[model samples]
Target: MWVRDDVCGLGPYQADLVETYWRWEQDPASLIGYGRQQPESLEARTEGIAHQLRGDNIRFTVYHLTDGTPEPVGVTTLLPDPSVRTAEYVVMLAPEARGMGLGTAATRLTLDYAFHITNLRMVWLKVLAPNKPAVRAYERAGFRTAGTLRQAGYWLGQVCDELLMDTLSSDFSPPSVISPLMP
Candidate 1:
């Protein structure tokens, strides 16, 4: 399966999976880790959804596993704009994979792509305040709490604050450090 920095050569089956991803993100609450859901069409299935997917100055790329199943486990991407050399980022792991540490691994891989490939100065993501697990993961991943946007989101009938966490290209340490220490 495709499991690298590029999404430029997805075959038909992989492309179909990417389309299904857009459909699944329709629920606002369901998109806690992904930000807001956007409208999509069968005709709009391009290799990269960055130009179409919107949330401030962010964008995303569909990521696949190395297995032959070709199933997509999550989406990841870079956010590049004139005001910041950093790329805004986001990721949403499948529910069943939540505690498996896959999200953190996927995040670190993406960061490596952003910095080494995209040559970004920094990479950042916004997480809802209540998502303690994610916040902790970001912390463990070498991202510091850069700032917070109070009541930045209105999800689940309540105003939710957002934590803007970031890691500089120079600050990101490899997840391999933890892998050796884990059982």
Candidate 2:
């Protein structure tokens, strides 16, 4: 387990956790803030995880450390661009884990890993504008609003804007004392 603050980095994709991830993707409530709206089959989900594991992406399951056991809560990923020095960040937390500040902690930890361990020069993400809590969380993690793609997504029977945000290694200020777990 890779420890970081209150969470730990868990896997490349294990057979036992595939169903749990599929459940998260199928839940309509969880689809509100995400880009993909379609429900995926079990096989498709398994294939997607396998592809990610074999691709130029670094993914981890976020687990909240509770009492001595790590409870799985979410997932985070860094997809490297062709440039090789930059990447896009994506994170999703289980509904039960939201509002506990885990998102921010996990994001910070991920960013630290990206910049410090992987030596990425920049990281970016596009979030649905209506995801206010997530925008705030990203801002707290040092991401600046770069721009917006107007009416870029369809959700809840309406069009929504997508906010593009990014952060550079020069601008990131990692926690001085946190020891990030290296995979």
Candidate 3:
């Protein structure tokens, strides 16, 4: 696991955690932040989880540590475009886990893993503009605005812009750690 000062860690994804992810994906509150137009049924959600588990993406279950016990609080994924050595970063914080900065911490940890372990060139993400908290979190994690898709999303019944942000492998201080998971 990638530990972060007892606040959160990125643990290997496990099948048993599918239900937790499904719950977060279906939570209305989470949907708003995720900018998901609709919630998935159990069948669809499970199928999607299967895809992740099958190695179609690099995923991790985010866990919050309570006195050393890790409780899952979110998930992060990097949907890779291997040909270009780039990927789209996606993260979802459980409804009860928002506003605590776990998402930002997780993003930073994942960025380190992406560039150091996974050997990716760049990582990018699209977030609803109305989701200020998420935007701020991504920025805090070393991402910079790449561009914006004006009114490209619908949030809370209003059309919202989608902000594009990205970070290159060279954007951060030189990496000091490396792992076996290379692309």
Candidate 4:
């Protein structure tokens, strides 16, 4: 069954769809990576992400384009801290799936799930400092800068900071977009 959120549609993953999703991730030239080399095998990447999904530490969901196909256009993972009342989120969308407002919609929907469906007080995430588009999207969706971790990520060659951002449960609503902003 497909689950509808205000921003995007999601569904439980099926093993058969792994290959298609795998190829999307394998393409390092995609928006998520900078034309870097990818894992040698799609199977390897699929298994790794699947393992994460099954593990106790994370909750995983797959997203499709607004058209509602079974083919996934994105993936989201929510990793709870040891306390389980707080968690961090990571979302990645295919290059073609972005910039059409899907990211913002999907994120707002995720925030609702994080805050209402779960017992979370805070939902946080870290984005690479250079990813300005993502930063802007997070801000528009109600996430505020919590802090930054300097030299936290060493990608390509030089070190980079990760901008830590957060949204509180009290700051979110089911009608997420139209809700009044909290002070």
Best candidate (score: lDDT): 3
| TM-score to true structure, per model | 0.68, 0.89, 0.90, 0.78
RMSD to the true structure for each prediction, in A, is 6.7, 2.6, 3.0, 4.6
Tens digits of per-residue lDDT for model 2, 1-183: 654664445444455687787786677756878867777799988878777666778888888776588878888889888576999999888888888788887888788878787889999999998888999989988899999999998668789999999999888775622344333
**131, model 2: CA deviation in Å?**
0.8
lDDT of 4 by residue, 1-183 (tens): 244554466565556666666766666644333324446577586677678656865434456544656446776667888665898887767777778776676677767667756668998988877777788878877799989999876455567787889999988755753233443
The lDDT ranking, best first, is: 3, 2, 4, 1
Q: Best candidate per TM-score, number?
A: 3
lDDT per residue (tens digit) for residues 1-183 in model 1: 223432211122234465556555544444655455465565564635444443343334334444544445555556576466777776665554466565666677667656665678988888988887788877766788989999887555577889999899889665332234336
> How displaced is residue 177 in candidate 3, in Å?
6.6
Worst 10 residues of 3 by lDDT: 174-183
Q: Name the better of 1 and 3 by TM-score.
A: 3
Ranking by TM-score: 3, 2, 4, 1
Any runs in candidate 3 off by more than 4 Å, and if so which?
Answer: 2-5, 174-183
lDDT of 2 at 164: 97
Clashing pairs in 2: none
> Which pairs of residues collide in model 4?
none
